[model samples]
Target: MSPRTEQQYEEIREEKKKLIMDTALQLFANEGYHNTSIDQIARTAGISKGLIYNYFTSKEQLLQSLIFSGFDEFAQFFDPNRDGVIEKEELHYLLREMFKLLKEKMSVWKLYFGIMLQPQVMKMVEKEVYQYALPYLKLLVDYFKKEGKENPYLEARFLSAVGDGIGMHYITDPDNFPLEECVEKLIALYQ
Candidate 1:
């Protein structure tokens, strides 16, 4: 066959990059970012360090890429302009979607929560992650306020803390945790 086209090359490159990121996410999440090295990532991913460098200049950039890519998947559900105002059904939909993501994309969220506790990684990624998260947080606060919850911002923060707790529990003990039932109860609590 003739040589692959440019688009095909790019697609292959993206696939390799994703493999590297996924491996690094697991390594960083479990081993800690500072403890992990590019050599470890390359070995885990079954690729050479040079190949990883071709896609990511450094481990910091690789971690940043993983963080954004993980959050980006869930961000689409939080677009406020999509329907102008949030509704109860929309809130339920959002909860279901978030739970689904927590279950289905556990690695991404694991890496996220793991890195959040790391001072070094948090320093590098804090601002961008807050920017990524603010819209969803604001929507939650606004929804609580519209629903007549007292101290809507604090309520929103509590709701977020609950979600984070559930995520941590589910990730830590997924098979034993009643994830779906817990999410249903959480939805009811918010309503």
Candidate 2:
């Protein structure tokens, strides 16, 4: 076999990193982050404990990576055109896509809500969470302002709270949550 190239090595590294993150997400969501150990994740991923350290400086860093990755995935749906303004159709698209993502990545969202409910875990990541959230909140406020809402910031916050409630309920009872209907109502509300 020909010697592996640099690109091949990078691909292997990325695959291993994803494997570790995926395993960690499962354990953190189902088993609780504090209860899950690095050794446990390494064993689950079929890698050495040391390998995880190579990818992440610490377990907290790994958790942060998982959380940040989910935020990054969400960024794509928020402002696809990179334009400052959010049109009505764009708002609708964002809601539809957000629900689709929640359905598709239940485990990730479960971890998110799980972390938020745990005061300690939430404290650990609060700054980073706010860092990711502020821009999106600003965009929503701007959109609501353009829509002539008297309390655009409040409207933005209300929509965020609603989204969080929907996500929490859907994750808790996905089989009968009426997610599509909720999404339709949310879209209409914003319009």
Candidate 3:
């Protein structure tokens, strides 16, 4: 193939890779990852298992990639801009932004909630997410520390825990949670 033709082929390949990953996530959510097989994923996705391998070497790789890609998407979406550091005032914005994001990502969030309790899945998620989260958490904490908050690290982690709790409550019983209001109330303390 010519260089331009080869480039187009690569683009098409990448799109197929993403399509497989997306279908795999839905199947994994609906059928459970351990129960879902590569052949099933391929059959559901209307592609051959050989084609799936062109994208992901194994089911575990695909699952890990799904989790990692979600984190990557979150990293991008969490930022209001391409700017590296989050301003202190943006902390408030982050709460509503995250809640909105979680609400929008209900399917994936549900998968996340269900899978986290599984030891192997939990380990994989923790390894992938914590590596990504810690630095972002540190950035948030440093922003608070600069603003003269004591124990910024602990406070930052606490906010994450609280947010997770509220998010889970919202997912399970949104009518009862009033999550945005509760989150806003908590954020008031930081101001």
Candidate number that wins on TM-score, 2 or 3: 2
Q: Which stretches of candidate 2 lie over 4 Å from their true place?
A: 1-5
Alpha carbon lDDT of each predicted model: 0.86, 0.90, 0.79
Report clash pairs, candidate 3.
none
My TM-score estimates for the predictions, one after another, are: 0.89, 0.90, 0.82
Kindly indicate the candidate among 1 and 3 with the higher TM-score.
1
1-191: candidate 1 lDDT, tens digit per residue: 74998899999998998899889988887787888989999999999989998999888899899889877767765665465458888888888888897888888888888888888879999999889878777888888888888898998899899999999999888899999999999999866
Q: lDDT of model 3 at residue 107? A: 55
Residue-wise lDDT of candidate 3 within 1-191, one digit each (tens)? 47678779989998899889889888886678889899998998889999988888778888888877877888887753345567657878887888889888765766676677678888767876767777778777777787777888888788878878887787777667787787888788777
* Top model number, lDDT: 2
- lDDT by residue (tens digit), candidate 2, 44-154: 999999999989999999998999888887776564337778888988888898889999999899999998888988888999899888888888899989999899999
Comparing 1 with 3 on lDDT, the higher-scoring candidate is 1
In order of TM-score, best first, we have 2, 1, 3
Query: Which is superior by lDDT, 2 or 3?
Result: 2
TM-score of 3: 0.82
Candidate 1: what lDDT?
0.86
Looking at model 1, report the run of 10 residues with the lowest lDDT sum: 76-85
